[model samples]
Target chain A: MSAFVSISLVYLAIYTLSAWSLNLQYGYAGIINFGWIVFQSIGAYVAATTALGSPTSGGFQTYIFGARLGFPLPLIMGTLAGAALALLLGLIILTRRIRPDFQAIIMLVVAIIAAEVVSTNTALFNGANGLSNVPQPFNGVMHLSYNNYQWFFVAFSFALCIIVYFGLEWICRSSWGRALRAMREDDILASHVGINVQALRIVVFVIGGAIAGFSGALLVEFLGTWSPDAWSFVESFVVFVSVYVGGRANNRGAIIGAFLVPVVFGTMPSFLPEFGYPGLSANLEWLVIAALWLTTFYLRPAGILPEGRFIARRTRAREQAPVMPPIAKQGSVA
Target chain B: MNLYIEAIGFGVIAASSIALGAMGFTLQFGLTNVLNVGYGATMSFGAIVAYAAHLTGMSIWLALICGGIATSGLTLLSAKTLLRVYAKRGAALFEMAMVTFGIALIVEYAIASITENNTFSLTIAIEHTHALGPIRFTDVQLALVILAVVVFILLDGFLRLTKVGTALRATAVDPDLARASGIATGRIVTIAWLLSGFLCGLAGGVFTIDILTVNAFTGDSLLSLVIVAALMGTAGSVRGAALAALLLGIATQLVSAAGASGYASAVAYGVLAVVLLARPKSVQGGLVADRVQITV
Candidate 1:
């Protein structure tokens, strides 16, 4: 009922943010960041650690940077944590012009290894069980109903999304975004145009990381739990599929694609008839996604809303004409 | 000292699996210039096929052949059918990787659905161990290492001596030039796919044998380690892959033995990152703008 609507809205908003963050990276910039989820995971982990206070007293979980930060501090720290990882990774990968595929493989490997570490290290985010019972902001002061909380979250997240959307849109249309587009089309040409291709890539990458961090923070604040299950390599693919299916290089398309895939394709299966085994339906979900990915990849590689071509403004008739006196112009020839 | 010996033994055994997988991966990637992320899924498919055959009471040797053939057929079909379509359409390297990833997801999920995502264990009854000086080794481990060495020697010999192998190496270096020189580049690529696929399948089967478990995600997990080994070897060099595999296996084992259990995978990834940073050339392969193009 109303509670479900609230929860669903929160989920939708959070996923939209994640999708938008990815759009900034893969759409505007040609960087194939296959391991995008790692940034989000770091953000969630950091935000949780900061809010949980110290683990020295042997709490349920042990994590670094325990500080019980009140409100905005946790969210800010989350963004910083994600940006830090991006900077570190960018410094390493952005050094030379490696093949894009190799770059992707490296990211995928980093994410897989990262997930394994998080799951195995009991002291780090309480191992696979993850940190739970995280207190939501204003939960104590507001004393709101579950439905109200949902509405509140939906409103708050949408507000953040609007800011991010406008901010990202402005940035993409800016000189920096143009440089990214140029780089995407042809790095050599972009470089010839006096653009520092590598530097531009890193800048956009860090920005994308920041967005991812904010998205992760928003998600954790809403869900009240963070675990390894929340971020899987397959989940990364799901996001990629959404972006690709919706339209590459189109923010609106990306948002629409994200909503359609995660909500319709990903969530709808749960409500269907019980399959062979309990998890069979879940397994089939991935199969459908794969089929959808391949279909889109082959049929519409450019996506539904492809990158729009920039057109120049029309000039007046007089301006369009050469507007030269024929005698004066032919004097030299005569 | 015994613990160190045990780690070394395990490292050697693990290295055999990586070596086989890496050699196949390097060869396929070298010639095709495709990352082939679906390779791990194909490996898993091979392992499952072998496991199913074993469950059906087939001889282990026959199961190995069946798995190898099955993987080879799948690889060839994928390369000829789907990959060729994209390649013909001039898909970027990254786009190809995406395609392969999609294919892998499909294959893996299909297998998961079929198997019900159950973990099947295949225990090797190798209780007997032989002591060589201060180190002890199991029969299966010894056999695996020996098999890896034999594969290395045979592959090296083939590449150096045979006409087909010479054509493969020529094509690997320059497909267009090889084609201009009247070599059937298509046939060569197909043969490469078949051989590499067979080797990948064998690696998968051996991996399951060593781990004594078969699961859909087994090859997916092993893919990174194999890539590390392949990349470390500088790609296209079988000997280098084997040596790198040995190093990686030893390094991971040592890290785990040092009580840094959680960071062991991280340690391996750390090596990959270092290699990436240190040797960017290995990743680029002379193509500055080469987007990942994984056909099969």
Candidate 2:
């Protein structure tokens, strides 16, 4: 396969993971994490900086906490960084008794704030210039051509995607997910039912944050570069558009929706005839995505592939059998 | 000491613009419960209208009125067409926000496509400067402050002293109750939309003049700050929003004066997050979750 196709597959896998994490949060848990992209940026920065070793300071880029680490360690560190950030923010956000709309706006504010802070405090993550020349995993061990290395990474990403997919699927099918649905329906009622709503939201948020970070780590490692420009607050909306357009509560819907929106539509801009200028297609791409979002809400609010109904299994055949009760005679009015 | 005083001066100017926008935002949000993210787009469109008027040699005051009228129409159109449709479908608060966001994207991008994404400078002819104590102000800035104060008095009086205003307050608190009380809740809502839309557009025009630049991306970028003020002030209270806007403005100006200019606008968000963390019950109104209706 061509390098282009391999690159596309890798993106598909990465976005699929992101969509899944966001889906779990917004879909099941009803935590509107509008700042989701910033967490991914954290993972990318941590992964890239750790893999790149110490910054030479005056020699080139400027950043804090530069250390030379092995491939797996950087990836692990990236995931941890994402979780740490989420754990910190979720502590405050989840504990609040605010409405969902308020929560969404707060998250939005955080997303914008994170971008400005990161770009402004250049010493933290090398500012707007960002980090480049990040080392790729198995670069020497595999001894493969660059194009083939991409294919390898794509396969690796897909494998990780499968693991995460099954893991999240298992969790969603558990009692925790049922509780999450209840909370989404009514927070006060959920708390009344003895469910620790705040604690559950925090748990789900952190887990989702970790997944987002992992995907970011995988993506940066594959690309061998990281930048503040890579993640914008609006990008979170794109991930949201995917999860929502796919199916709010369905994992399969998330995967398919990710593929359909980010994977397919994202790459389609390349095939479009150039209109006015070079960046025109890119502009039009976002426009199309926006149109797609509006169209989906109008036509199929339940998504193309709606969520499946969850029904618990019966253990015995007798339990599955239907029964009818005896009716009272019309004349027997005591 | 001198820079601190100077920053306070700038903060007041910033606050004036922010206050106008926040007042409008809080008004619509308090009554409609749409959390209309597309407000940013409407603001930009309004500013654009003002910009067009200025190009045609209209005075700054006329431009503001023109923009305000245009924005009011746009706001009502959006509320009636887009937001009402979704609300009718029983879309929840967050879903309504998503719909508004989609509308915002369309408006912002269409402007971008039309304007070709170019930044246009707003010309404010500041003829003279008046100085008092350690502060100095251009005539344009003075006019803005006056505009803000006048709008506030008018809106406050409109919301308090009039029968429609009473009806609006009633509708805001409980739409069904207001409807049952023979209040013509629909007309009051339409009036709210008009008044808020005017404020929204007026704010846009004032912001462009104050900042000295206008662009397709202008309103959306300023939106976060506006929202922070509106939310922090308590959604339905105009006085609360105005005071919050003033505080935010001062904080941002002080931050910028301290040299971290990029993080200045972020102060509003910091205030919000800190407030949320500090007082959950107060912020959530003591554990009573009010389901906000998106319709009039």
Candidate 3:
């Protein structure tokens, strides 16, 4: 029970990080990244390969490249991998002024193709079986009991989450975050106002991708496995749903959403007694998630905790400053 | 050379299935302005329904019709009820797409749970094999090709000749204007949904026949190709969709024949990506925010 509690805490932290990253991209920036899971999966694969060292010729798993990197280095490389991929995709997707829906479909297609490529190219990530036996960070040096280590990892993950949460809060409340909202509402107008919409979009995309990568690395280090099944395209939707349910453009909502959706509702089924066939519960879980998504959209489009209006101090001062603007309007009307 | 020819032959068969689905997708998307990602799930549902009909001792052809009709009703009902609810609630184009995706998940998992997550093999006895030059096709494949051609002709005729078809075209172009011109836009949209849904279902049946397998995810797996074909073609242009489908079908088969069967679909998607990158104006014009109102 303690192990379960620790693992659930870790998952909650990881999912919260993912939801925050996605909220940064879609909720704030208005970039509908339908292929969000690919970024996370890429991060996991990179971290696993880097930490797993070299693969033997007839070993249990085969990957494209391997290295015996130290703990921090693998995580850093994973983050970089995600950022680089986001850069590549952003250049392709955001460089042009395609319709938002078209951009989304492209991202979805990319996710699907990436999954297919990774699963089919056995040399890349050991085919559908995926890369397993990923080395845990600090496992050998700590010499702690397994349960104690789990708690340690959970604490480590939650610490990172707090850091990310505050970092995202700082960013979202900045002038640049306001620029993202402007772009999301109207890019043409935002560009007219000299916001450099394209550049801002790419930058935000990279940042979100890095965060997603970091979360993926942390999760893989704890679980010690990464597979295609773990990060399917549908998983991206799960995060999207979390962001939607939690409240778009609100970091606290993202955390709440991650806890409620992926952490609570996602794990609730496992605790129930097995009544139906083996896979029925899993399918039913997905069905309920999808239904909940629709219900959220219908009942609470603004989410449980909608984004609060952010009135800057200067704006408030300007609004409060005495209304002396009727002179020209009265003259014009006369 | 023979290998390439054989690939081309197989490409024709694949194109028939793709064209059917792409045509329906493009037509409805152009008219309704909803991406309808649930389309693939609806196709899967239709195929499963057809399989069930076949199990009930119905002829395969009749079963296909049943599947098409069932999907048509489902599509119409969803459009009239579920989609309309979202649209009325002010969901934009992207949000509507997300809604459809949610619907897709519900339907897909429902099917998965009912089927026990098992893939069912579809068996239809092939009477004979027909050879054309270096290409060989079974009877079923030949029938599918003929079915595609016949549907295309009928659809083309309907779109070109009928007044309702003209209304559909007009509504697709401008809904308010079509209404101003005394066309009942609502009825036309209903027709669009039903017709497109039927085509989508038929495509699923033909695809199942080609692959000889049925599963909850089968249509979704084929959806990328369908979307590729639909986007490659001009929206609402049946001929363009058919031509694009043919092109993609041949490209995928040739790529597979070149020994990288796994990346065949990727190659087709690459073409779309390149098209999108090179000529965004031709494929998807500059961002028109809120210009496309969901018409469901």
Candidate 4:
């Protein structure tokens, strides 16, 4: 039970990080990154390959870019790889004024094709079987027992999660974050008001990609394996559901959604007694997730905790007059 | 040379299936402005229904019709009921796509649970092999090609000659104006859903017959190619979709023949990217209205 709790805590951190990244991208910047899983998968593969040591010719598993990197280096490389990939994709997809729906479809296609490419190119990442036996960070140096190591890892993960949570909060509260919200609301208006929409999109995309990559690295280090099956296009939908359910543009809502959707609803089913066929529970879990997604969209489109209005601090003159708030409210009403 | 020729033959067969699906997809999207990502799931459901009908001792052709009918009803029902709910709730264009995706997940996973996640092999007996020049096709393949051609002719005629088809075209261009012109836009939208759904189901049946396998994911796996074909063409132009489908089908087969079978779909998508990059205006122009209103 303790081991399960440790693992669940680690997953909670990872999912929370992913949801926050997606919230930054879709919820704030209005960039619908339907290919979000590809960024995460690239991070995991990079981290696993870098830490797994050199591959031998005709070995049990073959993968490119194999090296024995130190713990922090692998994680850093993973994050960098994610940002680089996001830069490349964002340059191609975001430079133009494509319709948002069309852009999303292109992303979805990219994700599906990426999976196919990875699975078929065995020499790249050992094909469908995927790369396993990834070395754990600090396992040898600490000389701790397995359970103790799990708890240590859990603490480390939580520490990172807290750091990311606060970092994102700072970013979301900053002027740049305000620009992202403006872009989400209306990119044309944001641009007219001096926001470099294209550059802003690419930058936010890279930041979100870096976060996704960092989470993937952390997950791969703990799990000690990375596979194509783990990062299917549908996996991105899981994170999207989290952001939508939690509440867009709200960091607290992202945390709540990460906990409720991926951690509670996504993982809790496996703990139940096996009743039907082997994979029935898994299928049913997806059904429930989909149903939950639709229900959330229908009942509370603004989510359980809608984004609060950001009213500017009142100046002395404004406070004395007290005239602008009603006008603003009337404009919104009209 | 012979390898390329044989690939062309295979491409033609593949194009038939793709064209069927793409035409239906483009038609629905043009008229309704919903991306309908659940289209693939509906196709899978249709194929499953056809397989069940075949099990009940019906002829394969009749089973295919049953599949088409089932999907048509499903698509119409969802459009009238489920999609209507979301649109009325003020879901934006992209949100509607997400809604369809959720619907897809529900239908796909429900089917997966019921089917026990098994890939059922379809035993379609090929009675004869016909050779035209260097390319040989089984009886089923020949029939598929003929079916595609007949459907294309019929659809083109319907859209060009008929008054209702003109109304659909007009409404697709401007729904508000069509309504002002005394066209019952609601009825036209309903017909669009029913017709497109039938075509989508037929495409699924033909795709299953061609592949000779049935699974929940099969239709979805083919959806990317369908989408590419649909997008490569103009939104509402059947001719453009047919041309694009042919191009993609031939390109995919040619790539596969060049020894990288896995990268064939990627190559097809690459073509779309190039088109998008080169002629951004032509592909996306006039398709997206300044204000996108869901015409359910």
Q: Considering every candidate listed, which one attains the maximal DockQ?
A: 3
Q: Encode model 2's per-residue lDDT on A169-256: one tens digit a residue.
A: 8888887888988887777798899999888889899999999888899889988878778888878989999987899889989988
Ranking by TM-score: 3, 4, 2, 1
Which is better, 2 or 4, measured by TM-score? 4
Residue pairs in steric clash, candidate 3?
none
Q: Give the alpha carbon lDDT tens digit for every residue of B247-266 in model 4.
A: 89999999999999989998
Off by over 4 Å in 1: A1-4, A271-273, A311-334, B285-288, B291-296
State the fnat of model 4: 0.48
lDDT of 2 by residue, B89-174 (tens): 77878788988898888888888888887889976767999997788999999999999999899989989998888889999999
Candidate ordering by DockQ (highest first): 3, 1, 4, 2
lDDT of 3 by residue, B64-129 (tens): 999999999988988888899999998977889999999888889999988998999988998999
**Which has the better TM-score: candidate 1, or candidate 3?**
3
Better of 1 and 2 by DockQ: 1
Q: What are the lDDT scores of the predictions, listed in order? A: 0.82, 0.85, 0.89, 0.89
> What's each prediction's TM-score?
0.93, 0.94, 0.96, 0.95
Candidate 2 docking category? acceptable
Candidate 2 chain B worst ten-residue window by lDDT: B281-290
- Put down candidate 1 lDDT per residue, A67-145, tens digits, no spaces: 8889887788889888999988988777577777777878887888889888988677888998887778777789998
True contacts kept of 2: 0.45
* TM-score for chain B considered on its own, for each of the candidates: 0.94, 0.96, 0.97, 0.96
